[model samples]
Target: KQKLVPRRRVLSRSADLAEDYRITSDNVLHLVLKLSDLNLITVRTTCGQEIEFLVDRYRNVISLKHHIFQEGKGFPSQRA
Candidate 1:
């Protein structure tokens, strides 16, 4: 009789590993994964114009605000 062992699956892409498992103490990997998964956010301007933006999920409020300001014309006075 022969004993058999299960083969571990290999992840071809870094993104796959990042998404599937919790990598301990890997801030760079986490950041990379977060940046890769983009979320679409819709914002209504004070002038009543609706705009959509594709942004990273892990972006902080300040970073988001800066992005909105640079790409979306102007930054809102209130928190987004």
Candidate 2:
């Protein structure tokens, strides 16, 4: 066991480097939400009737409109 204690770890980048210093000890839950998770939001559409949609965040209203068109609730998507 003593012989192995002085040997360099295979996974380590260098022998001089000890424990992993770059990575923090903070818990994952403590960090801000993921980009994908942040995008998961609810959207309400009222074309004629009320409709709720769980969609990712869009850069603009046109993108949301495009998404609605793709859903095929009423009008068919021209672009597909």
Candidate 3:
């Protein structure tokens, strides 16, 4: 028999989009791995503009690095 590898379960948006579990701009989300119990993350977004996601085991990107908005309408483009 051939070896079997398990795939990571993706959190589908459809399943959580129902009326019972409506997703809002201020709602917080958690990504948990039921199989291995290894990956556990939490994400929170404000006004649906920016998000803050972090894993319990990692400490690399736990803060902001740049401005939330860089450009907008009638702004100059980056192309030459």
Candidate 4:
């Protein structure tokens, strides 16, 4: 009988496996993981106020516009 091991466990123990598969790089491993959580976007208002917000990369532009509107900022209205 053969025993089976989970790929996750094997990859965790072996750096070579990860490197060969290009799962991560030495410098960017943490950064790549962090990018999944949020992306930073800087918005400059007409009043010269610079605002920074963290947004999900998967969100659509319409949703982002609504978010900015809720923050009391103006965004160009979308036409259907």
Highest lDDT scorer: 1
Off by over 4 Å in 3: 1-20, 35-80
Tens-place lDDT digits, model 4, residues 1-80 = 22213333333443355545455334333211234557888877766666677899988899778777777435443444
* Alpha-carbon lDDT, every model: 0.57, 0.44, 0.36, 0.57
Position 67, candidate 3: lDDT: 18
Work out the TM-score per prediction.
Answer: 0.42, 0.27, 0.21, 0.45
Candidate 2 structure quality by residue, lDDT tens digits, 4-25: 1222333324453334433334
Off by over 4 Å in 2: 1-47, 72-80
Q: Name the best candidate (by TM-score).
A: 4
> What order do you get sorting by lDDT, best first?
1, 4, 2, 3
Candidate 1 lDDT for residue 47: 61
TM-score, cand. 3 vs. native:
0.21
Candidate 1 per-residue C-alpha lDDT over 1-80 given as tens digits, one digit per residue, 9 for 90 to 100 = 22211223334454464446444454333121323477888877776777778878878788778876776666455555
> Relative to the unseen true structure, what is the Cα RMSD of model 2?
13.5
- Prediction 1 global C-alpha lDDT: 0.57
Model 4 off-target regions past 4 Å?
Answer: 1-34, 73-80
How many collisions per candidate? 0, 0, 0, 0
Q: Please provide the root mean square deviation of candidate 4 (C-alpha atoms, Å).
A: 10.4
Find the number of clashing residue pairs for candidate 3. 0
- TM-score-sorted candidate list, best first: 4, 1, 2, 3
